[model samples]
Target: MKDNFSGHSDSYSKFRPGYRSELISYLVSLTKRQQCAWDCGTGNGQLAVKLAAYFDEVYATDLSENQLRNATPKNNIQYRTEQAEKTSFDASQFDLITVAQAIHWFDFDAFYAEVRRTLREDGVLAIVGYALLQVDESTDKVIQKLYSDIVGPYWDPERKYIEDLYKTIPFPFHEEKTPVFHDEYQWTLEQLMGYLETWSAVKHYMRDRGENPITLISETLKQSWEGFDTKTVTFPIMLRVGRL
Candidate 1:
């Protein structure tokens, strides 16, 4: 898959939001066995660390060594540098497999082939992500401009999958109906800025334009953020679950 976050691995581990417990609980509930799990494109081991608590073993893989290096260590979680489409995993190895916020970067057909090869017959494959963050209407307006007007062209074509909430992505399995979930956090303007900087589109813009794009909207964000030092930023979680 793509290795966009490796350069800013530390910032990604620090600024990226964690998955809600409810989401994790639901994934666990779907699994018939908690024997093992594979978290592909597991940047910073965010989801793997949580899976470690439920599974006997958690294998987390990513293309970037820098990202793997920054991953949180756990006794049951084994971090590896590997691609999403190919791996050394044995057939019928994992009870559950997950790709959080990174499936858009994968070769879907190849990855699905690997999933079918390695995943147990009853195993669940969960694809998870979050939509654009929503603050108040005023703050959202400035952020949307930055997202659409400033760095819109910089975003990769794969981003449309997230925009459509994964509905448009190819899913060739027995899909399960999932409940809607959200990640809510009380974040300062600085935190929001840091999160924005983690966007792959922002990185692309910086590389092409030779300047940070967030600067274009800093003052406007501050002006719109005036009444509150901290505000609840909600990200509607996008999830698609299925079985082999």
Candidate 2:
């Protein structure tokens, strides 16, 4: 199924967590000098702008035009509307490449080939994704249940693909798992519901069922958020970085 991200671009940019500055700094230092880089599936140009800040140029590509339009970065970052698997970058032209939270939605075989083609010898390839907020057992119990019972089913397809991460992908990347990072957010019940509705699962479910997931998720989260403070929430994040 086509990933429907256009509708949630605004929320994603606002709410979705970004890679750490430490990680970004590491990405810049990988080549040991400024060089050309590509930020594939660069949703809203978050990492692309960072890549451009150090690299000579950054080719930031995404399938979502609205995300490109919404990004405002101060760097030599060129935005393109292209799918990750079918980008038209010159072969062996990049010194570094990164994908943030988007590898799950790609044709891995084609993407890996593209990475191999575009990256210079010993070029860095960083493919990373983070844990979802309120999607864990250690956090609020209600939040965990909501994710498992409500969002889990719809997200299973993509989640299953990501399970093998660096193991299944045959790219020449050195893999390292980051120490889990945590984030805290202050949200009202309504705000929490809004976040839930922005999830791919909820959006896709809404499309298929022809019902307001907003209303449903809101009601459900409201009933569930009683024990926990809706205003204060903590989210633990786990990230796996595959670097070449």
Candidate 3:
């Protein structure tokens, strides 16, 4: 299971997008108290670090030691090496629990049970994700071909949960309306390539084929990316916020 990110922790830390402040503000408004938050599957402490600014204490846990090692520390955030389904936290200790971009990899039955065990009744649970990124129609075509035709077969089956926007997942909670937000970035071709290098499917394709598959799309991507100073890209950030 940990092998999914076997050696890509560095790329993940450097390249993965961060959550927008609007999402954080919306979560803060929903919580009755901003006492504590538990960020499960907190790979590289991305969201956890941000949560630390709002919550008094932030508990960030992950199964991957290397990912934890790569995490940048904050005074209020505590990092732990642990699985999503099993934790040593006290019962009803968290006012908020967040799972960002990593929920598809969790054992849902075990994780939801743990969430109920750990979260306060008034606590908010936010399952955060983002859809495919878009720069422009032309750039999107190159990316789509690389993602669908080239690396699609290499993606783990669980990725469908993200593709479907978590619609089929069992989320038993009193749902709350959330604000609309998008995670945007102005990145050069190299930065975009760096981000693509962090994809699990790309990693799988490299390991199995003994060659970097992203290289195949370099020429095609240049067609759209070369002349632009820095392409503007955006992802529609999705949040399923609720309470038990």
Candidate 4:
């Protein structure tokens, strides 16, 4: 089955964590010039919107029309309906190119070919991903059980690239060492549930089994969240940065 995200664009836009400003600043620091950046697979423009502050222009592309429709618009950001592997822009057009949590879905050869074509000789390419979110120990255990036991099998095989932090992807460029980064969020039980519902595996489980898996663990999670006005969740952000 194809990896489809159009159906959950709303939840994705609302619940998916945004990158830290420090991360964006770090990526910007690597660029020779901030004239242009292309944010490939920019679901809801999370990274694209952040990139707008640094680049003179940001081209954000996604294959899903619904995703682009829900993207936050900025004066410097241009949202486009285009595949990651095939964009219409000319050669050597970007000072930087970034992919946020969506590189696993790409046809690597085709996408990298396009990247080599569009990126300037001095341009940088950044691929970013976040590890699983963690709440308190008890709550995390409950969520981990749900992830590993309940929805694990439902996740696409492509998820392994992210699980390994994209170590296996053919990254043929001068690599750069990046500082440690994490995206942190404070959320109530309800908010946590909303975020969990946005997982692609959870969505797949619901569609395949015709039952919401979150419902199976809701009471357990609530119990674990007891006495907590809000829970702190953190995802360790992973980056693969290189120069062309």
Q: Which candidate comes out best when scored by lDDT?
A: 1
Q: lDDT rank, highest first?
A: 1, 4, 3, 2
Tens digit of per-residue lDDT, candidate 4, span 1-244? 1447899999889888899899999999888899999999998999999999989999999998899999999999999989888889999999999999988888888999999999999999999999888877899999999889999999898888878878887788889888889888888888899999998899999999999999999999989988989978999888999887
Q: Model 2 off-target regions past 4 Å? A: 135-139, 162-191, 217-244
Report per-prediction Cα RMSD to one decimal: 0.7, 3.3, 1.0, 1.2
Ten consecutive residues with minimal summed lDDT in candidate 4? 1-10
Give the clash count for model 4.
0
Tens-digit lDDT string for candidate 3 (1-244)? 3447648888889989989888888888889999999998888998998899999999999888899999989999999988888899999999999998888888889899999999998888999988789899999999999889999998899889878977767788888877778999999998899998888899999989999988999998888876797988999887898899
TM-score of each: 0.99, 0.81, 0.97, 0.97
Off by over 4 Å in 3: 1-3
Flag the better candidate by lDDT, 3 or 4.
Answer: 4
| Predicted candidate 2 versus true structure: per-residue lDDT over 58-147, tens digit per residue | 889999998888886665888999989877899988888888778777887888888888888777777766555653243356555556
Answer with 1 or 4, whichever has the higher TM-score. 1
- Residue 4 alpha-carbon offset, candidate 1, angstroms: 1.2
Model 1 off-target regions past 4 Å? Answer: none
Q: Which is the winner by lDDT between candidate 1 and candidate 4?
A: 1
Better of 2 and 4 by lDDT: 4
What are the lDDT figures for the candidates, one per model?
Answer: 0.95, 0.70, 0.89, 0.90
The parts of candidate 4 lying over 4 Å away from their true place are 1-3
